[model samples]
Target: MTWILVLVAIGLLSAVLLLRTRRTRQKNEPPLDKGIFPWLGHALEFGKDAAKFLTKMKDKHGDIFTVCVAGNYVTVLLDSNCYDAVLTDTKSFDLTRYSQLLMDRIFNLHLPNHDPVSERKRVNQYFNSSNLSRLCSTMRNNLQFLIASADTQNPTEWKKDTLFDFCYSLLFKAGYQTMFSTENDNTAKFTDVYEEFRRFDKILPKLARRAAARDELKFASSARKRLWELLSPNCFLTGSVTQSWMQTYLQHLKEQGLDTETQRRAMLLQLWVTQGNAGPAAFWLLGFLLTHPEALKAVKAELCSLQHLPLDKTEDTPVLNSVLKETLRLRAAALITRDVMQDKTIKLSNGQEFVLRKGDRLCIFPFLSPQMDPQIHHEPEKFKFDRFLNSDETMFCKEGLQMKYGTMPWGAGSNLCPGRDFAVCALKQVVHMILTQFDLELCDCNASMPPVDANRYGFGMLQPDGDLKVRYKLKKHN
Candidate 1:
């Protein structure tokens, strides 16, 4: 009798779900794929390989289509034609709200829900033209200290290290000290907090699930607590002469009447944001150079030519800048997402229109649409070091067209990343320093490009599935 009742309950649930799905399809929505499972939807398939899945769908259903993933329907715009719609339609689409949702789920904390525009403006001020020169000097000093310290035991021998780990450690320390003060006495304690934060970051996909179990929640909670403890006012505020960017941020939080715990959580998020994309990006940029000998030779020659110029003026090295741009294009799996605040009609450049209802999500996968579009980038799969350089020593473009939204590694419009300028400068400095100060080579010259972690698709930069080993020895002059 119990078995029969269980079967009846399952049957009723399936019937209701079928009816709801039919109703959703009846509306004038983009083509929806619910996949095989009911509520699970296309989450598994989409998670496995986002670019390929989206490409197959785009080929079948034009540039616009919807896919149900974990009970939410997301409409993807997959061509340059629809770029303006995502960038300009800020009134109907809200990126901040979407960002907040992800942050809340992953961190398991409720941040003060407020307009981020003012915050963005304030942060941008810190990275403005006047302040960048000083910041760059600080970063250079930090990088030099890190590299020098690593060779204390045996300076003459080549050190074998994983590029990802080395970059992450160096960047995390440098970025932390640059934004925050370096006066803290508890370096060991802060290092502990950083490790915990990394562990928490790795399990974000599991934690984002609505049905996340207690064990997962417990781990995330513990990590957050440790981070909060380390970033407490007593620890973070002490031992700094000049005012750090974090000090100003803390002051703002205090003025907003947020509690100490909230402020710490906010700081943790900031720490993650500042160093997150940079480490992986630096790794890929250097990795690409190591694998391609011709590109390496050209970039090295460019660096040699610019040796007479001031190291602070990274803009002078246009070839290195082009390589960085290409790396961002190839490695960044940026998923620009917006929540539909109200019902709206989205008209594309190709004369097709779609009605997006309230609560729906609109996303653009730049990895597929623009970055790998052969129409815009010839031989998009291959790494061309000078792809973004022109004969006139200016930025390259597609078919003599400007293409404003063509290469959006940092993003577009009001939603653009505030740390973009700082990130670019930091990457250039790291690469320039590495090339000039060290003699480096891949342990395995035949090692292919590292596979991108598909789960990190929507989170700005894509990380490698695993670390790659490289051998290095300090140059005599450095």
Candidate 2:
């Protein structure tokens, strides 16, 4: 029995060593699967320019290529043909694995058990189509308050301020209002938390955030416990409309006997999604707008036509909607990630076979693919706001659906963003406010549209690297 145990251990060690050697050999041999780098195994190459790196590889190695990640081979499919298979094909791939990693590291929760489908449904309930009016009103009130606060706090500096910062302020305020029912007027409190989160997110040498991730639970736990105390059935600030809607879900669960850990997780998830993407979206929109003057003008025109109130919006404004779509195509956030759930073979139309084994990462860099595709738009580099605006809605839909690359701003497939509607509504209101109130132009003489260093995570959904300093003059009518 002892001899057998020794043999088993030896066999496991042999397998690990063999896998490591095989991966190392694959790294040095070019064109076995193109984009294979020396020593670094495509890591260093990709680390430099994540956005266009894959596209560049595809230009050299066809559409299919493999890279060694954490000592495993990850095959990246470049075009739209396999997008459906990789992203939407649940039998083959799943986002839960990647989502779980992020949720655990960033939000300190178990995501697979969290029932993303059910959570999405619940979130859908919160942003239901019928409740569009209410949501819009909530968003508008939030927008007005954010803008007014910015104006009040920094009237003169507001013009010279970076649009990216403005985007952060807007997203933070909206998220605070939506989840907490209070505008994030506490800049110090908000900035401290946000900066801390951002600092933690950066995985740098000697700066680990594992402890900080634990602290998220600690913070949520304390907040939930305090809320329970402040409002035991009948409450003052607790009964406020904003607090009720935001906190009711958890409050109801507590009444029904939820465990402390479970309740803490639920609250954290609620807070995470509301705040995570808002700031990034704002930065991207402002960055794109700063670069593309014509696009910004069209967006402003659309906003002017649709806006009835100074702070709010009317139904869908087409031009503004198009501008938002185009901007997202140019800059969306949260890198689209998926996990290989099974030993799946991806068969290419060209008769190439690639095997994606279980536990491998399937990431789509839509930021690079969507905006740079020549077939998708005329003059891919130039910002044409109406590129997505087709005369026939059906044709537009087909054109959009057929785009294999450069089209995945919010990602594609089943897990495509559930919060897209809310994001669009919020962005439209913010852009409308900015355009209606201020005449904006790029103040940074050196910068152009889609500023460089946009791609950080080697995914296309990168926001501009720095704050977009824009010249803002009060509109003549305003």
Indicate which candidate wins on lDDT. 1
Candidate 1, residues 1-478, lDDT tens digits: the string is: 9999999999998887775455365366778776778776777777767787888888888778888877678888875656766667778888788778877887645666556677788888888887877887787787777778778887878999999888777777777778775475445764676588677777666665444568877887888788777777656665556677888788888888988878888888787777777788988999899989988998888887555335456557878878888899898887778888888877765556778877878888878767887767788888998887753313334455444454778776666788787788788878877887789998998987788887777677888898789999988863
Which residue pairs of candidate 2 clash? 50-458, 80-404, 291-449, 367-460, 369-406, 370-406, 370-407
Q: Tell me the whole-model lDDT of each prediction, alpha carbons only.
A: 0.76, 0.58
Q: Each candidate: RMSD to true structure?
A: 3.4, 6.5
Error of 2 at 136 (Å): 2.0
Q: What is the lDDT of residue 241 in candidate 1?
A: 63
- Scored against the true structure, residue 406 in model 1 reaches a CA lDDT of 49
Q: How accurate is candidate 2 locally (lDDT)?
A: 0.58
The residue pairs found clashing in candidate 1 are none
Model 2 TM-score on a 0 to 1 scale = 0.74
Residue 223 error for model 1, in Å? Answer: 3.0
Error in Å for residue 290 of model 1? 0.8
